[model samples]
Target: MTPFEWILAVCIAIMAATLLSGLVLVLRTSDVLARAVLADLIFYTMICIFLTWTLTNPTSIGYEVALLAAIAGGVLPTLSMARIISRGRR
Candidate 1:
């Protein structure tokens, strides 16, 4: 494997660990706000894992999917903030 591959592997590993730990925290925590924050951590970590993977297995479709996922990922924080600001009002 090349240096880039090794770096990607390490980065993915770290993200995976973060993802798992965040999952645990989300499960154990009682506060609603804390769970919301941990959920974002888990979501973005999965996105990072996917992005790192595309580095090695480059594909045209992969880039398009990643772009879409990234845009969707942005939606999470926006909605979360909106909920927080409005205090969950419709």
Candidate 2:
């Protein structure tokens, strides 16, 4: 494999490990806010994995999906935070 491919592979492996650890944290946390934060971490990690895969195999369709997913990943967390805040106020 080329250097770039090797680097991407390493990054993917590290991200996978991080994702697993985040899952554990999410499961262990009793607080709603904490779980939300951890779930967001997991979501971002999955997006990273998808982007990395797309890097190795460039395709227009996949790129568009990845872009949309990344955008949604950002937006969902904000909505979740808003919901959490609104519920907390009550």
Candidate 3:
């Protein structure tokens, strides 16, 4: 395998480990705020996985989806975290 492929594999392995650990944290934690944060981390980790996958298997629409995910992922989760923290207060 090429050096670039080797690097990508290593990155993907790390991301997968992160994804698993984040899931475990979300499951085991009792704090709602920490759960919310972990949820956001998991979301971004999935996005990173998608982005990394595209590196090995290029697709015409992959980048577009990644862009959309990047945008919506940020806004929706931030809003959710704020609302959760405030208990729905303005």
Best by lDDT: 3
Q: TM-scores, in order shown?
A: 0.86, 0.87, 0.94
Q: Report the Cα RMSD per candidate.
A: 1.7, 1.7, 0.9
Kindly report which residue stretches of model 1 are placed more than 4 angstroms away from their true locations once superposed: none
The local distance difference test score of each candidate is: 0.86, 0.88, 0.93
Error of 2 at 26 (Å): 1.0
Ranking by lDDT: 3, 2, 1
Cα displacement (angstroms), candidate 3, residue 83, comes to 0.4
- Candidate 2 local lDDT, 1-90, one digit each (tens): 999999999999999999999999988889998888888889889888888989888877887877788689878789878899688564
Report the C-alpha lDDT of model 1 over 1-90, residue by residue, as the tens digit: 999899889999999999999999999999888888888888888878887898898777887878887788888687976797678898
- Residue 60 miss distance in model 2 (angstroms): 3.9
**Model 3 Cα lDDT, one tens digit per residue, 1-90:** 889989999999999999999999999999999999999999999999889989989899998988899788978898999999998999
Please identify which of the two predictions, 2 or 3, would achieve the higher TM-score against the true structure: 3
Clashing pairs in 3: none
Residue-pair clashes per candidate? 0, 0, 0
For residue 80, model 1's alpha carbon misses the true position, in angstroms, by 3.1
